[model samples]
Target chain A: MPRIDGPIAFRGGGFAPSDRTWAAVATLVGVVALWQAGASAGVIPTLFLPAPVSIARALWALTVSGELWKNLSVSLMRLAVGWIVGTVFGIGLGLAVGLWSVLRSPGMALVSALFPIPKIALVPLFIIWFGIGEGSKLVTLAFGVFFPTVIATAGGVDNVPRGLIRMGQSFGLSHTAIIRKIVLPAALPAILSGFRVTSSIAIVLLVAAEMIGAERGIGAFVLSAGNLYDTDNLLAGIVVLSVLGLLVSWVIGRLERALLGWR
Target chain B: MTDGLRLTVDGVGHRYGGLQVLHGISLTAEPGEVMVLVGPSGCGKSTLLGIMGGMLAPSEGAVRCAGDVPPDCLNALTYVFQDFSLLPWRTVAGNVALVLEDRLSRTACAARVAEVLALTGLTDFATAWPRQLSGGMRQRVGIARALAVRPACLLLDEPLSALDAQTRDLLLEEFASLITAAGTTTVYVTHNLAEAVRLGHQIVVLSRRPGQVRDVVRVDRPLAERRAADPDLMALEQRLWRMIRDDAAVAERERIDASD
Candidate 1:
């Protein structure tokens, strides 16, 4: 053992701790700077790869013209509605399967059978069933977000310590009280992490749904720009989607910090 | 104080499939007495504790609790598990308040929680989460939670085995006093002989594998007067050790024989 001290420090070949914010910012700035330089020098064709400044200009024009917000808001609305529907239902069923043996096997079988089928592949089928409108698009996004949430929530519930459950039982806690006071709080970390995964899935499905048959989403904006051969606007739409994903992730991170502070 | 409940384990035998873990183990923890079960590893002391606590069913025989359980008590028999089993999300007071929530009025629950926290010397850490506390402190929280219910019987499964030697020694004295003060019939399972002698009014020594009662020794001296340096305590520890020692050697030989 090392000499007794204030604290023992073990160097296990792990990455040294540092302020990573500056490094992350520097990497992004460096990549954009290199792209801008290449575009100006004509080594990369402007049509093939728009300069960062040009993409920014297109984004500004779309924003000022109120077009970007229109498409972006539509995508956001679809995402919110679909994700909420999927999450609420998934969590309800997940808790059922987690707690009740009668439901576990059947629920697990259905999830396993459906989880592997690429959700995007079912878009045309959804369109036929629900009609080529917001209904079909909402269904597409909801279906895509549903399965992973179920898997994650059920797994989280399963991971709660058996000792805690036994403690609840020994104390003569009612079934509802045991679930509400013990199981839910103990399993919240896993359930919240499941939310993170399902939201990402919802985003992917949102874009795909819009691409197939939609008029006013970021995906639709990109598709129209592609048809018109406007590379700058297409890249601008892609940038908006990237920022949306980053914002969702940041929100989820904040939720985790707030809810899982006990950890 | 009203007499505590009598927990009787009558010729209890337990098995997991074909493997017998305990056999013909009969014992009684009398009201207001501390009964420590001591044995070698794999001797099924914990399994027996679990059975006595009504957490598991014995393969043979039965465990019965008889006496006046307080009418308002939420749990007549509560357990302190080896791992502390404190819910990470709840504060010290909140965890203690858990069993009392449905059983008592809101103010009564809070008062009971406060009382138990004080009893366990955890009043200052009422709002602290389990993860913020040391291992010894967490176990105190466990004790506080169990005591909050004012159970007729307390079943402890190696409550001090997880702590370091110094912490164990320090807590052992506090534990002895606290249990004495509570005066609830306690069934404590431990591998430590010193702890057995220090805490138990009666110590039950068990043989290795398919554990059966080898000897039951009663300590006549009061807990407070039973010091580590006392010859009688030392002698009792040695006697208990000797009882388990032969069984341990025989177990080792049997294990080797089977492996070969």
Candidate 2:
């Protein structure tokens, strides 16, 4: 085994862990500097677009007002509920199609036709059926994410090497046993990719559904602020959305590494 | 080992599209014996091994497993594939554990995995992924997978063919010793005559594609009868080669003449 003499750090980053930490700090400052310049030079309008400082002030005020957390919690709840339901159905449908050729062609046809229809287009119909509450929002987001996850997962399952499954069965593994142990593990990397992709889709849909109709959520807050012509608060919501996206993507990356630890 | 295992191939044949890949191939691997199938490339030797392993069903006839192990266990018959069929997703230990997953209990599985990992000198590498290993280590993992199963009979589909000469010798030495320790009834398929000579208790030579059993060339000589100095094994090699190479020439001529 190779000895871990030191930390695995990037080339020419120096030996200090603090150097890496300081670099991140510098990057954030640079972004704030760029935003300040853009706002001051009128590349961004003062009334409609807040400077970095003003957006931060808006964020601080929103936090103090408890509006940011309330909105964030609602949006996150919708995303989680939608993503889970979507992923469960997607994986189940994917396996059904992959295991049977008769299912494969019909299943693919369904995905192709249904996948392209803009999910948000159903909002008015959803509003009519379920009212402008969590139900409609969750269903819309779930519908948006499910097909892509199903398609990706099914492709992964279909492409699992026949030799491994045969190995499992030759040892007298029952059909269900083979699926639970061998097939799932074999398809994990691809399935993880499906979940990752679906979560992002869920995030996008969550924001859209909120913007369409909701009392509190980053999206709804931004949209309402726009109606009230509170541009700085609207920009503050945009910043919040971008930060959430970055965090989600980073966390997903870490989860991928941990799940594929064997690989 | 329950008198070893016997393979009774009764006139098995297979056709693909308009072409026959194997036809009327018949041979018997007796108990406590090593039957080496030797032929040139594309000679249907591998296809025949596939039939014996039940990876491929014969289009015309059935493969019978007599003595120990059920006929369907022929389906259970595992092969050390010609290409070293090690799964890239599994670690060295995981690949080795694959075959034994059913036979052993959870604790036994872990213990057996540890045993084989040490036996294969993969103890330090139990956590290392298959893709991280060298070709030699990957092939060792393949061998370990077969061994871990503790199958009634073993199949080797020219596993060492992809290896270099030096590594091949070292591996062959280890393989022979290891299988001898386990006392497996093995069917080894190889194009290399020296490997067949070194490993087989009995060598079965095959003709080209749509292969038939040309002859069963027996190496009655014990491991001790193999004289390192006399080039005596060279005689066995030549004998096996003559039987296979001529058939190969005839098969190629028939192919060219057919193409014309």
Candidate 3:
């Protein structure tokens, strides 16, 4: 093969640069346009699903009345608390399981057994055990986030090269020094990726728990609107959840760039 | 401060469960000398080096690092790994600073790091991450890190084996001069006879498994004079090769049989 210093021309057809933002905006706008046209033409019933304009109006009304903010704040607070609790314990236990052979077998077995059970199914049990309040909802979200974090952290630590550890030993590094300097940095990329998954799981469980037994949250508002056949308000609440997901993914993207730039 | 430091492997033997790797291996690397252990594949050279570096305990006999170490010195021995073992998250300067962080003052550590980086010709790439460097450059960083510790003895296990042939040849010369400049007792293991003749003050040849000493050839000539083209060095390489040729063939056949 001949070597060239400048940018290589692509002969094989694969990835190419294009107007990605324009394409995304155009698709979304086209869908809303089609929906509006269908509703105006009376082809789609308004009771089952509202037009985009009606949903936007409902969203604007909620925003101005401060109803949206009230529900959003409560939901965000729950997510923050539950996710933090799960993450701290998950990382702590995961490091233990990964570093010590004694903990590996039992920890792995428990994670495997519990991780597969549907977390939403446990909400009723949580309510019974912790009482029907913030405790149950918080526990629900924490349970959802915990198992995946443990799995990810342990896997990350396991993937660190044995050769690097040996090198640390030969250089006369203490156990604590080796773990802090070598093992943690090597496992960081994997752990950060785990955060992305656990965050999504938290959002899912948060909504589920809120919908089941809560007076103030996006999930509660959406549930009430659906029962009253208020399609515009329901769709508006759904849009809020979608936007929250987008914001979260954007934050994670920035974190990846900041932390794992060496890769 | 590094004077009178010697690494002695006295009757060191090792066995991995049912497989015996080395037996009754004895050698001493004196102050400011490089001892090269050369043999065929699976001759247990690396295992012996591991024992000497205090990374492993021999099943029989002992490894002794005998000499006076300064009261201020934190590490007596350091190793250069064959795999370049550079942490991907750390920059070149960060990797070299790791060993010095515990023992030296912040200002002193920076000075030591700069000196070693300059010695390895890596001062230009101090802030660059390991992933951005080529294999040879990364190994240079590894060497710089090892030298930064100011160890009385250095152990290298086939440190140039992973590089491409041309890069290996180039770095081998750099390594020879760097070792001479450091003037620390060193034990290096390699399968290549040419590397053995070029770098070793004393070249030790070991036979096939249950590896025992076959010969110890002392090269009293200067490192610069031990060139590939020089007749004397060529003769030494040939002599080393002849000692291992029959055992290497036998080891290869046994390996094939074991695999089957």
Off by over 4 Å in 2: A1-31, A41-43, B69-76, B223-230, B246-260
- Which candidate would rank higher by lDDT, 1 or 3? 1
Model 1 over residues A101-176: C-alpha lDDT tens digits?
9999999999999999999999999999999999999988888878888888889889999999999998889999
**Model 1 global lDDT (CA atoms, 0 to 1):** 0.91
Candidate 2 lDDT, B209-239, residue by residue in tens = 7777778877777543454343878887887
| DockQ score of each predicted structure, in the order shown | 0.68, 0.27, 0.79
Error of 2 at A194 (Å): 2.3
* Ten contiguous residues minimizing lDDT sum, candidate 1 chain B: B67-76
Write one digit per residue (lDDT tens) for candidate 3, span A1-263: 99779887889985886679988999999999999999999998988888888999999999999999999999999989999999888888788888999999999999999999999999999999999899999999988888998998899999999999888888888999998988888888888899999999999999899999999998899999989988899999999999988888899889999988988
Per-residue lDDT tens digits for candidate 1, residues B91-121, read 8898898888888999999988998888889
In candidate 1, residue A183 scores what lDDT?
85
C-alpha TM-scores of all predictions: 0.94, 0.88, 0.94
* Clashes by residue pair, model 3: none
Please report how far candidate 1 places residue A216 from its true position, in Å.
1.4
Model 1 Cα shift for residue B172 (angstroms): 0.9
